[model samples]
Target: MSWSEACHLDRSLLSLEHFFSIPPDYAQTLTGGLTNRCWKIVTTDNKSFVWRPATHITKAFSISRFQEYQILSAIESSHLSPTAIHINDQGLLVDWIEGESLTDSLSFDSLLQTMIKIHDLDTQRLPLAPFNYTARVDHYWMLLSDEHKVPAFAEIYNRWRTAPNLADVGLSLCHFDLAGYNMVKTEQGNKVIDWEYAALADPRLDLTLSIDVMDEKPLEAVYRYCQLRGIEGVDDWVEGVLAWKPRATMMAMLWYLLAYQLWGDEQYLTQAEKLQQAFCS
Candidate 1:
């Protein structure tokens, strides 16, 4: 079923009455979600919160609302994320920071700073699950139709699947999706919104995606990141990110391809083709 259909069905299957302490004055569908459904809720007292509806497809996207809740709880004191309020098998609710999304005006340095704070949080005992890179990639690949599965796709997949993960680098709390759409500029400061893809993993993965999305030079971005994080061996870090670039690109390519297959959106197809050609060329 399409996302809209699932959401419509969920509306009938799920109720919002008991989830809240007091009845909300208003609730509306919040856009920008590609796969999941979220609602912006305003209580009688004028408090605003974001409610992410729980769905069965969480497994499909490798998302765990439970994990997200834990991570948010762990980092709540850091003030870099929204405060987690209530969570259950039904859905999740959190305070919605009032601000504009970092869509058109992305501040790369600001994002990096907030991200470093998250990385600096001691999560060694958080019990959050590690992001299994190979498993996630394979899941997306498996979702694609055979017609969309080009030979180069498998070849690239195998190469990256067998390659060694950066074992030398320590794992930290990484927001796998740091795109502008997931960031917001609140009155206090920048706050990252989505934690569906958050995990304990190689910090370089976040850095890799950050640099790619920011369209900044890889080496320069790594240098800046190292400088801010007080991480030495800039050249080595650069090398690690570069080595992981193709793997990251492959994962993005497969995601777009699968998204196109599921939704039949031309934009996803265009992006998938672009990513494919970049590395396949």
Candidate 2:
């Protein structure tokens, strides 16, 4: 289902009892996520909580709510994630993590250190499928014909299809979409949020994706992280990781094409053109 339809379904499913036994005194809207509606709830007792209604698309990509509860429960013990309070059949409630997003201002060393800490956490791996950006691009091309997204993307898509084997790379529990927007900078330290796409995958992919969205200084930190991980042949790995961007860009283009169809936004077409040019260049 579409995001709008999923949101309507969420609104229909939510009730006062879903979050708290008693009614909440105040509800504050939180933005950033494209998939779900997030709200900060303040109970009559002055306790703070976060309420998130899962989107239909996200439900396909993420672990079940119960599984998410278990995973978060284990990870929180290491103090890497926020504590999940309750997750019912309809929604989830967790501690409202307060902080700024690690957008442009976060230092490279700080980001790399934070990632290493998360990678070093000893939580048992949860049962989630690996994220294959190549496969996802192929699926998008199959599902939506060249008529949908820019046809030029297919060349980059094919180039990455036969890219070097990353199977020998190290695997760990990764926040699959660890971009600047998802990181929450707390007073104590950085706290990563949005566990929906969290899974066990090549740590290099996460590092690559994170650095792609960071400033030049953080790119250097990414190289440092690679060295500390004993990853030799930095040039080859950088090539492999950089190849991932075209595949990712293709995936984003598919989403925008679909969004444009629904919302009548020509800007989506404009963005897809830009990504297509970047992929080709």
Candidate 3:
């Protein structure tokens, strides 16, 4: 069914032509969106678009639609992502790239190249900050069942709180969430979506996250980042990332559990349970 048929798009401003110029005739919810409600829109001209509507904040850490648009506008044409055309009360509208996320075999060099592009982009329109690992962890941890608490919490918290977290790491735009969900491999090349969590921070944190999610050796990424940027004395920085790993785990655990709570999806619940066990062990 068309966008008009599936839902009540009662305003002319919300019409397909208003956004895409071509009338879109079909709309279906896309799978694996995980964070927001995304719909695949097929236009009468045969072009495809993604329609994502606003949802309430799921976790307490950080995600701002307005910030996403600002950063995106800065780098929209850098070929790192799809083109952004418009933003309405409904949500932002951008050209939808057809591709798969870079999950495995995320070549070190390729990943570094992408990171370089992001770090090099002119970002005068935005303000960014260091990764608030502690706040995010605390927020997510509060969502978990008390009985499932990790025994190492106090030990981990005290040491992590005092350690150097690279808070002063040079500020630059970073796609903070480098997990596969934000990546897509199209015929055009690799592209990252979901700008809601992008911010300015230590580019190294992006590197550390890339290592964590891609299941690659941390030293490999740290070494490459150092080589590319001509930096040194990252031992403390690397240690900061390692210290924050448990919180990363907690973030995942809470996301999955919350997914289960909201959608009653058993897969998410199962994954949450597994992560809880892993963290406590």
Question: Which sequence of candidate numbers ranks them by lDDT, best first?
Answer: 1, 3, 2
Ranking of predictions according to TM-score: 1, 2, 3
Winning candidate number (lDDT)? 1
Tell me model 1's lDDT, rounded to 2 decimals: 0.79
Evaluated at residue 36, the lDDT of candidate 3 is 69
What pairs collide in candidate 1? none
Which pairs of residues collide in candidate 3?
A: 100-185, 128-200
Q: Which ten residues in a row have the lowest lDDT in candidate 2?
A: 1-10
**Per-residue error (Å), model 2, residue 244:** 2.9
Tens digits of per-residue lDDT, candidate 2, 171-274, equal 67777666667778888778878776566666766776677667343346557887776666776556656655555555666655555544566986787677
**How does model 2 score by TM-score?**
0.79
Cα distance off (Å), candidate 2, residue 107: 1.3
> Per-model C-alpha lDDT, please?
0.79, 0.64, 0.65
Clashes within 3 Å, all models in order = 0, 0, 2
lDDT of 3 by residue, 209-229 (tens): 677767787766777776776
Using Cα atoms with residue i matched to residue i, what is each candidate's TM-score against the true structure?
A: 0.90, 0.79, 0.78
